[model samples]
Target chain A: MTYCVGMVLDRGIVLMSDTRTNSGVDNISVFRKMFHWAVPGERIISVMTAGNLATTQSVISRLEERSKTPEERSNSLLELPTMFQVAVETGKLLRETVQDTQSENGEQGKGRFTASMIVAGQIKGMEPRLFMIYPEGNFIEASFDTPFFQIGETKYGRPILIRGYDRNMSFEDAVKLLMVSFDSTLKANLSVGLPLDMMVIERDKYEPAHEQRIEATDEYFLSVSSGWSDALRTAFHSLPNFSFGQPGNG
Target chain B: MTYCVGMVLDRGIVLMSDTRTNSGVDNISVFRKMFHWAVPGERIISVMTAGNLATTQSVISRLEERSKTPEERSNSLLELPTMFQVAVETGKLLRETVQDTQSENGEQGKGRFTASMIVAGQIKGMEPRLFMIYPEGNFIEASFDTPFFQIGETKYGRPILIRGYDRNMSFEDAVKLLMVSFDSTLKANLSVGLPLDMMVIERDKYEPAHEQRIEATDEYFLSVSSGWSDALRTAFHSLPNFSFGQPGNG
Candidate 1:
């Protein structure tokens, strides 16, 4: 299991993904699920994956190879004409990778080899875009009406995002918001763990504005986590208590 | 789909359940998920149901009838000497109800007609107790280490309970805490919704200290729902923002 989120704010885009992977509770390991490719000022793209590790790793590796050696292949993620095209290419790779792996195991591969991804990036002169790509090679774009995307272990972290997200919030606050969101999932679920990868893209910059890997001991993260819990306790206490007010008929 | 929570607090027990039930999105209706039978000054027991409506309804009806007509019923729920025995009786009824339905449906009843319950109550000369009864008829008691149990569409509302639960909190505060938790689930899940039913059993009272059905327009509930959104936003902003602090290597 994994937890990843991508948000398209007015200032730009912010993306975060946990690094944990496990076959079973007894066998767990950390694996980076965030991947990105950039052409400096020309374009910048990021992909965060969830689901089967083999399928996601294969899709990302093929994408890297195609981008780095464009001449040897007809397809190149970096050479895609737009963020939408990038999503299409990435979705194609994810679907094919999953299909290839599933076909190998015959009847036993029903729901095992599936994977999904969040694609975020910008092209020169184009506004930032974010998408959630499905294992079936289909995707949806983030819009003003729905400015964020989250996948994997999303429920425990969602209420915070639904309540805290603001279109005009700064990149720093957005990251803060994601941190709280991730922290909620981290506390509730064992499948998502620390050493989270994050990237910030400023609108029209065509390059990452900020990037960091938040580890277990990151000072700011630790503070946000413990502080958020305390703040929640305070907020809960501040709420007006319910009055029995003449019990209703049962 | 449903959401029901039972908390074991020092003061007593607080139980809340949504009234929404649906076969499909279009086929939805209100069905009470909470049922209680109390013998004044002796004992109080509340049951909150989730899962197949038919199964839960049947179980509740059988329990209610047996409790009311003990002369003809050998296993009256009211005749149970201990809260543990009450849970055992309820679990037995629930398992039989589900199995009866499934057997009638033949092989097509693989995962259907299943249900779970939260049994909470107090008996004279004994402390308050809480139990989560599974569809398989197995049950576990809530203790200091695990003070609460939530069933159905539970994830969206869990973090709040996890962070805010206190054994020594007042009954009013406990209800307030449950309101917030239920509100979160109501907001995030369509299948777990409005007109929540709640009961507070103060220790040794052997009767509900209070009982109410929280409607959508119930002034206090409305206040809590909207107030929670505001408080969460404020809390999110109160946390310090993140600093990228020199980009990390990819």
Candidate 2:
């Protein structure tokens, strides 16, 4: 399992993903799940994947392969006109890769080769965009009403996002919001672990604005984790208690 | 789908459940999911159900039927000597009810007739206990390490419980913790909805210490919901910001 979130904000786009992967509890391993391509001042594309490791790797490899081939250069991330086009091409590649792998593995691999992804970035002139690509290669773009998209182990962290998200918030606040969301998921689920990969693409810059690999022992993350817990406890205690009715009155 | 949680604390137990029941998004209805049987100072047992509605209802019906029948008195909740026995009998009844339903419904019902339950309360002389009963007639008691059990649509609300729960907290605190959990779940899920049923069973007293039906317009719940969002936003703003590395330094 994995947890990746992509947010489209007024100022920019933010992408974050956990590094943990596992076939089973005993076979846990850390793998980077965020991939990015930036042609300075032209375009920037970030892809965060969840679900089957092999299928995602195959899709990424195919995309990289196509980018290097002269004939396929026109369809590559560097040559794509907009983030929407990049998302469409990525979705197609993802679907084909899954189909190929499932065919090779036969009937038993019907659902085993499936994977999903969050693709977010900006083109030189177009607005930054965020999309959640489904296992079947279909996708949905984030809108004002739903400014963020999350894949894999999403429920634990979603409530925080729903309550805290604001389109007009600063990039710093956006990152902080996602940090809390990710921190909540990390605490509630073992499948999602650190270190985390975060990328901020400031709108119109067409280049990565900020990027970091947040390790488990990162001082900032530790502060946020402990701080959030303490804050919650404080907030909980501050809430008005339920006044009991008379005994036997239910 | 449903969301129900039960916690065993030093002061007593707190149980909460949402009233929404749905066959699909278009077919939703309100149904009470929390049931209790108390012999005043003698004993008090609260049962919270989740999963297949029919199976849960059948299990509760069977338990109620046995309690009212003279011949079946020996196996009824009223006659159970310990909360542990009550949990075991409830588990057995749940399993039998599910099996009976599935057999009648045929092969299509194989996975449909499953349900889970949280059985909590105290007997005359035993310590107040909490158990999560599975569909297979097996159950596990909550320990200090795992002081609460939640069934159905549980993930969204779990992070708060992980952060806020304290075994020695006051009964009021316990209810507040659960209200936060339920509020989070309600915000994130369409399957779980308003008009929550809450019960507090204080230690030794056996009878319910407090009970309430929290409507959508309930002032306390409204305050908690809005206050939580405000607190979270304030906490987020107080966190340290992510210091960006040099451009291109990932």
Stretches off by above 4 angstroms in model 1 are A66-75, A246-250, B65-75, B246-250
| Winning model by DockQ | 1
Q: Which stretches of candidate 2 lie over 4 Å from their true place?
A: A66-75, A103-106, A246-250, B66-75, B246-250
**Chain A superposition TM-score per model:** 0.94, 0.93
Candidate 2: fraction of native contacts reproduced: 0.67
Q: Of the candidates shown, which would achieve the greatest TM-score relative to the real structure?
A: 1
Q: lDDT by residue for model 2 over B1-250, one digit each (tens)?
A: 8999999888888999999999999999999999999998799999999988988988888887844666655437988778888988999999898888888889887877799999999998889999999999899999989999999999999999999999898877787788899999998889999999999899899898888898898777788898898877776676777656633323
What would the per-residue lDDT of candidate 1 be over residues A1-250, giving only the tens digit for each residue?
9999999999899999999999998889999999887889899899999999988888888887744665676537678788889998899888898888888888998777899999999999787899999999999999998999999999999998899999999888999999999999999999899989999988878777888888898888888999998899888877767778734323
Docking class for model 2 is medium
Give the CAPRI class of candidate 1: medium
Predicted structure with the largest lDDT when compared to the true one: 1
